[model samples]
Target chain A: MFSNDSQIGDFVKSAPKPKNEKERLAALKRLEILDTLPEQSYDDITKIASYVCQAPIALVSLIDGDRQWFKSRVGLDATETPRDIAFCAHAILEEELFYVPDSSKDERFADNPLVTGHPNVAFYAGAPLETAEGHRLGTLCVIDNKPRVFTDEQKDILTMLSRQVTQLLEYRVINENLKRETKIAKTMTRFFENSQDLMCVAGTDGFFKEVSPSFTEVLGYAVSELLGRPFLDFVHKDDIALTIKEVGKLAQGHRTVNFQNRYQTKDGRWLILSWTSSPSADGSTIYAIARDSTVEIQKQNELLKSYEEIKATRAELVRPKEEAIEASNAKSRFLANMSHELRTPMNAILGYSDLLIEEIDSSQPAVIEDVKKIKSAGDHLMRLINEILDLSKVEAGKMGVSRDTFKVAEVIGQVEGLVRSLIGKNQNKLAFDISKAPAAFNTDQEKYKQILINLISNSAKFTKSGNICVRVFEDNAAGVALMVTEISDSGIGIPTDKLESIFSEFSQVDESTTRLYGGTGLGLSICRKFADILGGKLSVKSELGKGSTFTLRLPSLAAKKSKSSSSQAPSKKGSKRAA
Target chain B: MKRVLVIEDNEINQDLIARRLVKKGYKVDFAIDGEKGLQLIESLQPDIVLLDMNLPVMDGWQVAEASKVNPKTKHIPIIALTAHAMAGDREKTLAAGCDEYQSKPIVFDELMKKIEKCLGSV
Candidate 1:
């Protein structure tokens, strides 16, 4: 009487339209289920049922107002089917079992669209699905792509499991309906009362519906104070436009995550906010959460400040090295050019001075005096050039030091001989207070002699017509002390304030003293450098209107020899060969 | 009078040294450069040569080498005059065939001593 192509109620033309149509409608309506997202609990049951029944497909079908919808399905990807054509609709018409052992051969199913095509109900069986109230809504069914048979025992098991599915559906309808109402109320309460973050529900029109206590704690405003106000009223004026734009996105079903902004507190202080928000139903109410981010923002600001400082210090540090290199290069270039210029002129002076001294008659006093003056000037000029070159070499870090064991007294005698003429000419009384210097100390005798001569000359030049004192003393522990004093009527004492910087290169007590004394300001600087090279320090103590005392303290030769290699023979040979 | 050749580029230095040698009872010949000095030594056959290390045209080292090569001039003593007192300069001059070397701002007494030593050696 029925073709496979006919739908569930199609057989109703011959059989009185299965008695519980009204009751089935009531059961489907009471379930109140349609168009819901898949739940894992229901989906897992369908998967277990298909595995147990050894069927490839299983579904929890709920008959809705106008459709048979799947809450969950194991093999099907669709959500709903038209109620008029649903097979589960016919399965629900049966009392105990509705089974089609060979759907392809069955007169009722052979020509059915679903049986002939996909889902191809070639073998089928179903148990009537019912609620606890005895309302049959759908079926729990197994389907096969080919013809199959089911024993009576398999039919009993299918009916029992389908009855369990119906009970679960009834229980879920009652329980979830209560849960939905209660969850909505609790979510609304949590949106205001118990959140750690300052949360709020605001309308799309910018009015606040609710706010959490954390809002009052963080912003110093009560819920009542903010409830009726436009949300923009609490927003910092500078942040209002941005806040409006972000709020607009939330109303369009888009959620804003970590959208930071600022708000004005009741006391007019700005509070920084890191906020996230989403739109509720009707797209009118905005659910938002906010954290006070001012501390993090301050830290960010401090980090940026430190970064800028580091950049400045990096530039500052790099500039000096470049400048030092440039200055050294400039000095080197100047020295090379100056050596050529000055040497050429010095050649003439030395050569002519030598010749003039020899040519001048011993009998003629004026000619001898003229030769003497020329020789003196030439000697002075040569000394100046030598000093300049030596200082340059020291500055360039190329000055060579030769250590040798020579008698201190012997060096003193050499200096005396060299300056014998100057001493006699100056008529300055010379006094020597030698401790007889501890049995002739061994040192770099040449450098010691050079230092002595410089010191003596300075003393003699600065002082006039007074006793010049030279003293040599020794300590068993500390090395040696050579002191020179030139007492004079001039009374040009170095001031106390400028004494500390006096030993520095190119520094003098004052410009007036420099002008009067006529010095290159390199003597004391050279002395200090030499003392430092010898592992000693040179210092000065002075008082205004009183003579300054300069002290040079150096390690003795014994210490130096212990520290360095005992290679005096080669060094002496080198120095003598150089001279 | 013993003959002496003074090789130097500076006019003032040449005039002064020549006049001095003349007064000192020597017949002095002047050469403005090392090449001229070599030519003068070849022609005049002076007893001694006072050579300046820094000279125009040909320097003292080349003149020394040339003088040592010539058998006749090789008999004559040469004293090197240098203003650069750098290390190894004395050995450099001596290695160039100078009999003696002296640093300049030349104290006449020192130069006289070296010159006499060179003369006595030759």
Candidate 2:
């Protein structure tokens, strides 16, 4: 682009550029010598060129894109000049010294401002400053005002000085590269020394050849104690075999990452260390980084132990509950067996006694009377077995309820029939007041009958010639119909403290009451449980030696609401069909 | 004549049942276990069978199911006699094909009434 043909109208004719002008400019720029402060190295060369060439001015001038710049100058007023009139611009194109015998006589410089104006006609010369690669940059040349001729010796001296300037430029590049590398080396050294990880180098001799200062901080060991020692000396005995295998791989130029091992600290505590290692190019040394993982490993172990403990504790908690279920099942089986075994003999005793009574004649009244005693004793024992069986069924939560729509009179008539003989035992007067009783109520008829029979029978046992009244009433006080059968007796009453426990299984008013009154004490508890199954409650009130009233309250559900209507017949047939 | 077969394991209970049955003006046959009871049910073609639950070779439940399925003896009505006081015995025995169930220490009057009812149904 430095064209010589574009200066047609200008008084200052530009010099012709070389064929490789772009590369020549590149070489000049690479020296980085343009417009630089005067260095003593280049200034010494310029001073010598000025004195020996016997010229008034000398400069180490470099050719730039738009100007010729001087690196060092002597007897020079300005540091740079335009490339269009620069004498060094033409010098860069020459292989050796370029000479202008007199500027006024040269076509390129005849109209140049330096020659036509104040500085007047001048003699100029420049030696091409060439790189080792043979691209000429600029020149170290001397200038003198007034036209003069340069001898071959002066051209030779100028050529020699230009080479020295080129050498100085090349030296600057090498100096900068060295400075950059040194800074990087220093930073890398700081990273190795200050890093928290245990950075180390190990030789093939199995010794710790080098270690970062972090190793001392983590292991509680002095640097002197660790260097030159086999690193395996501190490894846990259990992990040494595996650690040796990893190190052997590292020795063969293989990397070892994700390797874990345990090492002993200075105070004889073991710490887990995880490592990443690489082999050197020649495989003579290994570079590795490690972090202490002791706390992390311990926490993992603690979590595993807690999981195991919880599983064991849960199993312990479950065992007793399973055993309790199994025990209850066994008890139920035993009760079933006992019921069969006891009732079978009683059936024979009672049946055979009845047969004998029928077969005996009136002349044998004593024999008939003994047969009657056998039947009566059998009846008492049979009742005790039945009551115990009923209580067992309730306790097992297996007692079935058979609800039906029944007239209140049906159950009351049955209860009155059952308690007739018991009423004769003490001559207890019985009465019924059914004024407010529901006409037809829905509930389990059999269970309700049993409750009434037990209550009246209990009253007959306690009273001697006292009145027992059965009063049935319906109440709608709570927006729901409840049929209450209140049976009160004028009998030897129970104490206040004994009232609650009397309803517990096998509990009586007093321990001697079981002996005095001929009955098992399970009657009341069974009555309460049956009342509960029917969705009702049985409660009692008593004053000592006055009377006791037992209240059995049951829901009088409408037949349409109940599953079994009275039309289904008054029996357990409806409940059986559901089963 | 209405013939009733009484199956009982205990000899005393068997004797007691036979006496009561004979006195009630019905001809009675006796089998000590359920195996004989089933055999007699086919051979004699009794009007009813009183099958006791605790017996050798077969129980009342097995006898009831076997007899009910048999074409030769299926016409006979079975009354299950058991000392087992399970509250669900009525449904349980009926489910096993027995026509009636009565708990033991049998009130002879109640049992006789049940027997007559089963006979009357047939």
User: In candidate 2, which residue ranges exceed 4 Å CA deviation?
Assistant: A1-197, A202-207, A214-229, A241-261, A272-397, A402-408, A432-445, A470-485, A533-535, A553-579, B7-12, B31-39, B53-77, B83-85, B91-99, B117-122
DockQ for every model, please.
0.27, 0.48
**Which regions in candidate 1 have their CA more than 4 angstroms from the true location?**
A1-299, A306-340, A346-382, A407-410, A428-445, A458-475, A479-531, A536-579, B1-81, B86-101, B119-122
Error of 1 at A121 (Å): 39
Docking class of 1: acceptable
Model 1: per-residue Cα lDDT over A154-187, one tens digit each: 7777787787787777777879778998999898
lDDT of 1 at A301: 87
Error of 2 at A265 (Å): 3.3
| Highest TM-score against the true fold, candidate | 2
Write out the backbone clash pairs for model 1: A3-A108, A4-A108, A4-A109, A4-A112, A5-A111, A5-A112
RMSD of each: 15.6, 7.8
